[model samples]
Structures are given as structure tokens and as C-alpha cells.
Target: MANLYAGIEGGGTHSILVLLNQSGEIVYKGEGPGLNKWLIGLEECVSRIGKMIRRAIDGIHMKSGIPLKSVGLALAGSEHEKSKRELKELMMDKFDWIESVESCTDAQCALSMISKSGAGMLLISGTGSCCQIINPDGVSRQCGGWGNILGDEGSAYWISFKAIKTILNHEDGLETSLHDISYIKEAIHKYFEVEDNTGFMEIFYAKSDARKVAGFCVEVAKGATKVKDGLCLHLFCEAGRYLAKHITAQLSSIDEKILSAPEGLQIVCVGSVFKSWELLQKGFMQVLQEYKSKKNLKNISLLRLNQSVAVGAAFHGARSVDQILPLEYSKNATVFSQIEL
Candidate 1:
């Protein structure tokens, strides 16, 4: 029988599971509820993951008793060492058929998509935002990921929050810009399904829903890309600048040799916000250029992963058992931008 491995990428919004054969071919793929242990209890997260894996095995027509060689879980809220160890233990206890279990952060799994050497930087701007860098020697450094309240700058949630604040400020006569913000105002009201300020305040403050707020970024993107609204464009540009700050903050502690390498550093960008790179390019490039002058860096490559990061989690599972999956790293990523400083 072929050795079957499984991987799960658990996010704040949703979770993805993939089963891979020894040849690195994805045989079964599935998605289910969010697996953040903080949002849902740890046991519940593990139970959901187990059910997904069992369904995948059944979907592939595998026998009920067939054992999986390994399983990898890349989940949000599992970044800390304590969480990783606890998750691995629970998965082992629940699934006796699994021989090995590996647990890591979603960011780490995303980075593994491109950097086999484990030497690269990853910036995530989804419902939340964070940046992480791993050196060639295996040491890792991180800059952001402070959740919505403390940080999450440049995230979808941030953009949506900014949009609401801008409208409120305008209504309060705090904003001096005479440029018509009627479109954005209307978009905000329609997105939250609120007819007035009182309704908006109730939904936003009473429920305090992060996902609902983050979803508004889709409207913000439409406003910028489809409607060509200036205020919406400014929000994205500002988001780009904040994301650039994450990179610069990480780069500050990097070795000078790594910064001056001829091939340059690889920066893997992940999330929904990057879909509108056309709008973000201006403010993102502007900050990068300024940082380049200050640091005298050689160059940098910005890339996007073509495949779902669940594949990376599977690769991590294979590596944990001293096995290597034959995958084309180059084909898995595309260079969106390369800056020569």
C-alpha cells in the first residue's frame, strides 16, 4: 500500500485539509470550519480535524483500517511551543492510526511553500496581519501578528475599520476633505446592512465581529478597483505602507550579508489583500524604496504562492519523518515584484 500523508491549514475564517500520496500528488482535498483553538476549544479543533481526515480517507476509497503515515497541522493560535506540543499530543491520542504528527503556525507552513532551506520571510495580510523571517541558520524572527485590537495593521479588518472611522469622522465634521465620500458611506451602510448610525453602532460595537468587519474589505477593493473611489484607494495604499513597515522591521535585525546577497532575499506574501496588488503597489513600493536607501540593501523578490498552503503543511509532515516529497518549489510560487536596491 502507498504511504498516505495528510495536512491541514487552519485559519481564523476556515480550514483546509489535503491528503497526499508518496508521490506528492494530492488525492483528496476538503475544507471545513475554522480550527483556531482559541476561538473553539482545543479538543473541538482536534475533533474537527480528525473528522476531516477520516472523510478524506473515505472519499479516496481507502479501507477503514488503513493507517496514515503522518499528519501535519498548521493552525492559527498554535504558534507557541506549548500549543504546538499540546496539539500534537491530542492528535496522537485521538488517532492511533497516525504514526507521526507535526504542528506549526500557518505562517511557517506558507513560508515552506517556497523556501525548502527554511530561509525566507513571510508577510500575511488576511483577516489579520503578521510578518515572520527565518534565517539560513534556522533562527526565526517575527514583527507583527498582534491581533485586531493591538495591531493587524494592513489587514482587511484594519481597512474596514479605517473606512468606518473615516465616514464617522466626516459626519462629525472632523474631516475637511470636500471630496465626495457618499459612495463609501453608502457601501459601508449596505455592507453592514444598517440603515443609520445607530444601527451601524449596534452591529459594530455590540457584536464586535472581526470576520464581518474584515469582509468589508471586499467592498473596499471593489470601490478602489471597480468604482475607482479615491478614498478607498487611499485606504489600500495606507494598508500597503503598513505592510511595508512589517518587512522593514524584520529586515532591520537581519544580517548585513543576507541583506547584500547577490540573489537577494525572498519575501513570500500571503492573503486576500494581495489580490489587489495593483492598488497596493504604489504605497508598498514607496516605503520599500525609502527603507532600501537607509539600509543599502541589494535587492528583494516578492512572491505569491500558487498552491494552497496546505501543501506546505503536508511537506512539513514528510520532513518530520525524514521523508521528502518530490514537489516543484519554483512552480509553486510566482514573482509578483522584484525590487533592486
Candidate 2:
């Protein structure tokens, strides 16, 4: 029987599972529902994960009873110590065929995607937004992981919400310094399938759906990129500035040397929002440039992972079991943008 490893990236919106052979080749892939314990109960989350794993194994015709060497899970809302321990124990108990189980936060798994030395920063701006930094000595600091109500800041939901609010303000005759908001207004109405503000309210406020709200960001991106709407363009640039703040908030805590190092600070930018880099670059670079100059930093590099973060979870699983994967971490990421002070 061949040694096999499993990695799962469990997010609030969706989850991905991958199976890798001993040589670091991915053999099977599967997807399941969101496994955030805060959004879905722990039992339901674990149950969905278990079913996904079983389906993957069946897909590969692995009925020979050869146990998986280890399973790595990077789950959202599993950052707490108690949640991590419970999830690990539950997975082990549910699958006697698994030899070991390691669970960690999804952000940590993302960090592993590029930083083999476990020293770097990860900025996430998906359905939610947050920044996490780990020093060379393994100390970790975080900023802006709050849910939508508190402070998603540069998230898709935030951008969408801002667009809607701007429309509402214009309708109420409160916003006077507006350029052309017709594109944003039309896009919002079409996206929500509503002709009026009342209809939009029912879907957004009455239903209390954050995911649906966040989905509108795609339309905003289209407004900026395809239609060239001024309002939409400004919204994206604003989101970029907010995201840059997530990085700057951690600067004081990180070692000054790391910030000024010749290699430059590597910041891993994750999430769908980053896909609109061209639209976001203006405000993003503006904020970063000002910060770098003031702090006297040498340079900063932003990168995006080339593969699914599940691969990193697999690497973590391999490491937890005292096994080394043949994969090269350097080739896993591509630099998106670099700014010099």
C-alpha cells in the first residue's frame, strides 16, 4: 500500500480537500460545504468534512483498507485552542484508518503556502478581511479578523455595502459631490433583482445574508473594469487602501530589521478581492508608499499563491507526522507587486 496524505482547507464560504501521494503529487480532489464552526455547528462541520473525505477515497478506489498516513485540516473559526483540540479528536475518532490528524487556522495554512520558515505575513480579503504576521521567532500577531458587523474593512462585503450606501445617500439628496453613479446604481439593482431601495432592503437587511451581499462585489468589479464607472473605480481603490492598513497596523509589532531587510517583507495576499489587482493598485500603492517612506523600510513584496492552499495544509500534515514533502515552497508563490521606499 502506498502512503497517502490528505489536506483540507475549510473556509466559511466553501471547503476544498486534496489527496497527495508520498511523492507530493496530488491524486484526488473534492469539495464540500463551509466548515466554519461559528457559522455551522461543530458536529455538522465535522460531518461534512468526513463525508468529503470518504467520497474522495471512494473516488480513487482506495478500498484496500490502507490507512491515510495523516490528515491536515485548516479550518476557519478553529483558531482557538479548544476548537483545534476538539476538531483533531473528532476527526481521529471518526476515522480509525487515519494515523494522525493536525488542525490549524486557515490563515496559518495560507502562511505555509509561501513561508517555509514560518516567518511572513498573510492578508486575507475574501468574504471577510484580516492580516496575520508571524515573526522569525514564531510569535504571531493579527489584525482585523472581525466579522462584517464589526469590521471586515477591505472585504468584498465592505465594498458592496459601501456601494449600496452611496446609492442610498444619493437617493436621499444627502450626497452632492457625486460624479456619475448610474452604473453602480444599475448594477446594484440588477444584481439584487430589485427595482427599488425597498426591495434591496428586503434581500440585504431582512434576509441578513452576508454571502449574497459579498457576491455583489463581482458586479462592482465589472463596473470598474468593463464599464469604467467612476464610482465603482473609486470603491475598489478605497478597498485597496483599507487592505493596506491591515498590513501597516502590524508594522510596529514586527521586528524593524525584518521590515528593512534586503529581501523585503513578503506579504501573501489571499482571496478573490485580489483578483482585481489592477483596479486596486492605485490606492494600495498610495498607502504603502507613504508608510514605507515614513518607516524607512527598504521594500515590500506582495505575492499570491499559485496553487490551492490545501497543498499547504498537506505540507503541514506531512510536517506534523515528521515526514518531509518533496514540494518546493518557492515555486508555489508569485510576486504580485513590489514597492520600494
Candidate 3:
């Protein structure tokens, strides 16, 4: 029997809690719906997470006869110190017996999953967009997480907003940067099940919620790509280029004095926005490839975490206690064959 550890990766779409043994094999796993505390309320969100934890604990102890000794939670909406403290306190209150508890932004946990020694950068483009860079020394810098109001430039939300505005502009016979949404006008109308522009406006304005509205990107992508709308394709490309710009700019922002990077700098990408759409991923990588070529930084590699981010979270949880398991464990695909996503 091996010591047990647990970890969680939480996001707006879903949450995964995984328990692992000393050999880095997943022993127990539980999944639940996602709730962004800011969008919902704190109590409801924490309660949902608590249910997931309890679910995993019940399963882990039942089969293994050993409780999780340590736990690491990589949660979304934990970008700030205050939120992290609040969530940590809540976890501690419920699972007081778990030793060496740690909490960090889900993005941080995603990075820990792909990079050994926590080197390289992580760019997430889902309901929102943000980038986290961690050098070998553990110091990190974050960019673009201003939320829907101020930033999140390359996010799905931004794309959805822009698409709606462009459609509206086209409907009103006004000039739009997209030139003409005329090609996909019928498709967009049918997709949203709206008869006309008035219905479109009413429905969009009524939804009001950021996540629900951002989901419009799915239709936007489908409509634009089906007809090969130049403007929509350009938007996706522009998004990729903008994300590339952030990546390059971070190189200059890192403090060289305190940080160290390993050979072949890795760019680990996580998020449904990039993952769900082939055109968008192509657009992003095409621009990123161009950027790499221009800068002659061929050491850069872009890799997506195909497995669940929960795998990363669980890896970090076990890593905290074991310390000897190579950080590169997750990088090797073979290591996770026994654990299904």
C-alpha cells in the first residue's frame, strides 16, 4: 500500500478531483459541474467543490483503506490572494486531517502538469484568456486576466462579442470591420433561431450572462467557417497573433536575474476555446510559428494538454509530498496511460 494524495482542477465548465497513490497512479477520481464564484455566489460555489471533495474521499478510503495525506487544489477564480485564502480556509475547515494542503490558480496547476521544474509559460483561452509564466526558480508573472469588462482580449468571450457586434452592424446597414456578415446572415439567424435582427438583439441582450453569451462563439465559428467568411477567419488569426504577441512580450518581461529556463522552452496551451475549434488552433499556431521564425527562437514548442487538467492537479498534489517523482512525469504520455481522462 502507498500513501495517498489528492488534487483538484476547477474551472467554469467543470471540476475534477483525483486521488493518486505513491506510484503516480490515479486511485480515485470524481467530477462535478463548474461554478465561477464571481458569477454565482461564494457559498454555492464552495459548496459544490466541497461535494466533489467528499465524493472523492469516500471513494478513495473505501478502496485503498488510506485517506489522502495531502491535497492540492488548482481552482479558477483563485487569481487573487484573497480568493485563494478564502478557498483554502474552506478546504481546511472541511478536510482538517489532510496535511500539506495547497491551493493555486487552475492555470498554475495546468503549468505544473506540463513543465518540469515549472519552467515555460501557459496560455489559457477558454471562457476567458490569461497567461502564466513560471521560471525555474518558482517566481511567476501573470498577464491578461482583467475579466470580461476590461481585458481577456484573445478569449472566446471577446470573439463572441465581436461577432455579435459585427452581425448587428451588418444588419443596420452600417460599416463593419468585418465588411459584410451578409454571407452568414441567414446562418446566424437560423442558428440562434431568430427570425430577424430585432430577435437577435433581444435574445442577446437578454441573456446578459458572460458565460452564456460567450457560448455564442460556437455558432459564430460554425457559421463563419461553413461559408468561409473572410472577416471571421481574420478574427481567429488576429486572436492567434495577439496571443503570440503576449508570449513574445513575456520573454522580455521575465526577470533574468532570478529565473532559469530549461532547454527548448515549452508553451503549454489549455482551454476549450483553442481545443474545440480546428480553425482557431490553426490560426493561433500559424501566427505563433511565424513569430518563432521571425525571432529565430526555434527552441519554443507548443503542446496541448490532451488529458484533463485534473491530472495535473493530482500530479502536483502527489509531487508536494513525494518530491522525488520527476516533474517531467506528466510530459511523458506513457506515464498517464493507466489513468483515463
TM-score between candidate 2 and the true structure: 0.92
| lDDT of candidate 3 over 157-251, digit per residue (tens) | 88877776677776576854545566556655665677777875566466556766577677767655787777677667667766766676676
* Per-candidate local distance difference test: 0.85, 0.84, 0.66
TM-score, candidate number 3: 0.80
Assess the local accuracy of residue 23 in candidate 3 as a C-alpha lDDT between 0 and 100. Answer: 66
Winner by TM-score: 1
Pairs that collide in candidate 2 are: none
Please rank every candidate by lDDT, starting with the best: 1, 2, 3
Candidate 1 colliding pairs: none
> Estimated TM-score per prediction?
0.93, 0.92, 0.80
Q: How well does candidate 1 score on lDDT at residue 216?
A: 97
Candidate number with the higher lDDT (1 or 3)? 1
What's model 1's overall lDDT? 0.85
Ranking by TM-score: 1, 2, 3
